[model samples]
Target chain A: MRSKKEKKEIFLFLPRKKPFTDWSKLLKNDFKLKHFYKSKDLLSALLFSPPQAILYYFNRNRTVFENLLQLKHNFNLVSLAIILVLEEEDLEKLSDDRILSLIDDIILTSSTPLELKIRLSLCLHRLTRISDNNPLTGLPGNVSIELAIKKALESEVPLAIGYVDLDNFKAYNDIYGFSAGDEVIKNLARILQTTILEKTTNAFLGHIGGDDFVFIVPLSMAEEISKEVIQKFNALLPAFLNEEDLKRGYFIAKDRQGVLREIPLLSVSIALVPITKGKFKHPGEVAARAAQVKSVVKKIPGSNYFIDRRA
Target chain B: MADPSEKRKEVKKKIRKLEGLPALPPIIQKLNALIEDERSSLTQIADLIEKDQVITTKVLRLANSAFYGFPRKVSTVQQAMMLLGINVLKILIMTSSIFEIISKEDVGLWEHSVGVAACAKILAEMKEVSDPQEIATAGLLHDLGKVVQMIAFKEDYEEVKRKVEDGLSPLQAELEVFGIDHAEMGAFLMMQWNLPERLIEMVNSHHDLSRSKKYRKESALLHLADLLVHARGYGETTYVGLPPFDPKALTILKVDPSEIKEIYLKLEPRLYELKFFTEELKREMT
Candidate 1:
């Protein structure tokens, strides 16, 4: 697994050219580039250490082109972005079809090194910022959250999956419109984000869509994060509700059966499922146990978080 | 010799008269309009996609798929736009509509489409194609005409299947019965949908790679991808035995003969993921 912050470099496979031209100097400043003259050198280097990007110069030789195409699967496997540079007339050979179908981008060899730097940086920036964040709260969505939990389980780490849900969200949404209800969800997300940031830097926050937010953190730091999130969420509940509802401490709303009943003020419940080694093989298992714990915790009063300490 | 133009006109007329021949979804037309508009923002295009629940869901699903290897989960249409960009999203929307229609007739064909999509993606990556997504989309909908044939001319399609069961290839059967192959019929539909000329050419010449004048390389990519999927025994079709590899296409792709085993080895593992994905798609669409 590649760490998030590491020294990343690009590998350039170009024909032999004079060293230290004006254009090459521009790229040398921002990127740590390693130049390879032969296909064998590049392929061998990739086997030992994969580069973030590959800059290939197209020569009219069919053998060289085929050899380069052979490495595309390997490049994709290691998440490498391939940039091809070819002459204008040489580009005409591929003009009859979808010319650059295999690689990430193509540039005219006539372009300046500054243009290359800008284009390459933009592509690299995009590669780094691939986030599947929930639209409402901007927290990571289920996929990222699930992937994190699975990685932790695979590593035999002491992680906790905290399943957070609002106890009377539907009742509140009924009294207030969906937009206002959305605001409350966003507020809760903010509370979770801030609590995790303030308490633990390594924690992962995700929105499991609609009134359900999940956070995965180290087991030791899980209790503190969950408690702080619940505390902050409860403290902000009054501002979320109207003055009339805040004064009454409850609101009259219809249950699923349409029967009128007084529902208590909105409170959040957190069910922390500790991910122990050998206990579970997948994230779905953690989700199942978290649901069981949530059923028990949601029944209790006020904002609270409890860890499921069961086999 | 017969006039090729006269034959093409007749084929176009025959395709237009086919019963239950569906047009491209209205959303695609709207998205295309937005794409061409220079003033349109990504937010505006995403907003239009958000109006359609199915497309939105599919977009998010593809963004998070293994093909993109997007590091984070893509939840919203806006995020999917950033990950896939407009070109890929357009192709995805078009194919999803086609898949929805064909899935009703034959679940096996849908699996085949998914399998072809995965294979084409790998092949395109191998060739260093600039737009793998477009080629993958073409692979997914390569058999659009066959589905239409089954829907419009049920009896004729039944005969085609019967012949296929008897060991005649599906293409040969279509030619025997209808005087036109599915590749031709598929190209006709692509033309009707106002699809990209490159895509139309690929579909038009997938079976006859030599005939592809402009999109020879792309057509070859799809041809090889289709053959690879057939060899893998995906999609419970009556057609048996792999289609002979097109020498012209092989030459155009510059693929080494020795690389066939390697291609199969890489494509084999991804087939499982594609099957799982197709099942999930069927569940969601229904």
Candidate 2:
């Protein structure tokens, strides 16, 4: 209900010391600012009314900054931009990729008010470009998916990357319109997302373009997550299909070869490839194995997953 | 006072840009507890949301919103919750405002809607309707226009009630006062929100079976369910007696006369189950 014309809210956490540049004059008329001295206060306020961005003046309190970042991840506050303000002496901290990935941008204490304002606006603009989420499902797109896979390859903990897609999806899409097809895709995305999120917090799920999805989870939880996803997908499938198609259990549609035949109802196929440290050098190798596993899973029919056992 | 025609236009324009309706406080409190509890399953949270019409509509609206790129496909609470993860749902519950200090009449209306939803789902199951949950959703939201009237057009709503007290039927009173009935008003808003067409049709035609074109059976089922709940006295509505019953609903649903008793028998236990929750909500309101 918040109107577009309303001033964007920015939560500022500055030190009580009077040595810094005046923030009020700098952000005057451009933003509605709420000042927070304590990190806990800002966090509690976020629960009720989240601001467009958080300007945290980071000192030596590494724990507080890390806790704030963890809270953002725990609550999935991906859109709430965090701009860190650091002293020039603390410039070396920017070399940490973890901190860099977590915060939107950094502002040096010596920058003028005009430079600070421009940096804030640029940070907000970059937030949009960085979010490569699939518009339909709001899941991360190929860019993030590749990054996640690369991270998984380097992870010391054993991880499983599941390549998920639909069998008979094209036939269903052909019979039903594009809107219904999109619904099925969204439904599958939900199944994968919720099932994976329920199992572990160290997991990643993304849409690898139309009908294709990828999820990275601990190797131990991969099978259970896949089974749950398949079960949920099957249970919610009937809601999307018409009574006639549901009654017949399949619909008559043309196959890719242009021959008319009865195509089975939509079913999901997940090809899970497990990764241990130093097993696969690149994400491409994992993709190659998953592609092979997917062929086997797709041939078996019904909703199922195939875990690649070969090294 | 504005002319009835002008008032109708104003209401339509307001609903077209409608953001949300205020939900009862108790429901929001209960939802927050359910969502914040780490042990609660998604189904449990979804079940709680399904009980309240306002929250249910809001959930469906968000899931089917253009931002999600699922403009009318998502219908059930479970489906919507799946798309909107628990974190987003938590934020939604926190932002949801309550009706300006809950009143007894509002509680009564909430109970009535829950009752109708239950009864409709029962009938849908009995008739082997596809997507019975969606039908139940339509049942819960069937009276949404009345809620809109209470919030946006307080004077017009009071006027309709006064006319009803003077022996005019609630529908006739609404038509005379607002130049549009609640059924049409609710449907207009639903269409504006881009809800599923089947749901819109069912809500739009709950009173008049003739208006239902594609989803006649579903609409007829809701019509019968509304009457049955009213007859059972589970909740209160503006109607002094049973609103005009279209016997054709029974014919359209292919429900036999003997099935009426069966429906009542099936509905009694569900209403009894819901009574506990409604009573608790009332206690909290006071």
CA lDDT, every prediction? 0.68, 0.83
For each candidate, what TM-score against the reference? 0.36, 0.83
Question: What's the CA error at residue B181 for candidate 2, in Å?
Answer: 1.7
Chain A superposition TM-score, candidate 1: 0.60
> Candidate 2 on A77-104: residue-level lDDT in tens?
5677999888898888689876786788
DockQ numbers for every candidate?
0.01, 0.15
Off by over 4 Å in 2: A1-103, A106-117, A120-147, A177-180
Q: In model 2, what lDDT does residue A18 have?
A: 45
Best by the lDDT measure: 2
At residue A100, candidate 2 shows an lDDT of 80
At residue B213, candidate 1 shows an lDDT of 92
Best by TM-score: 2
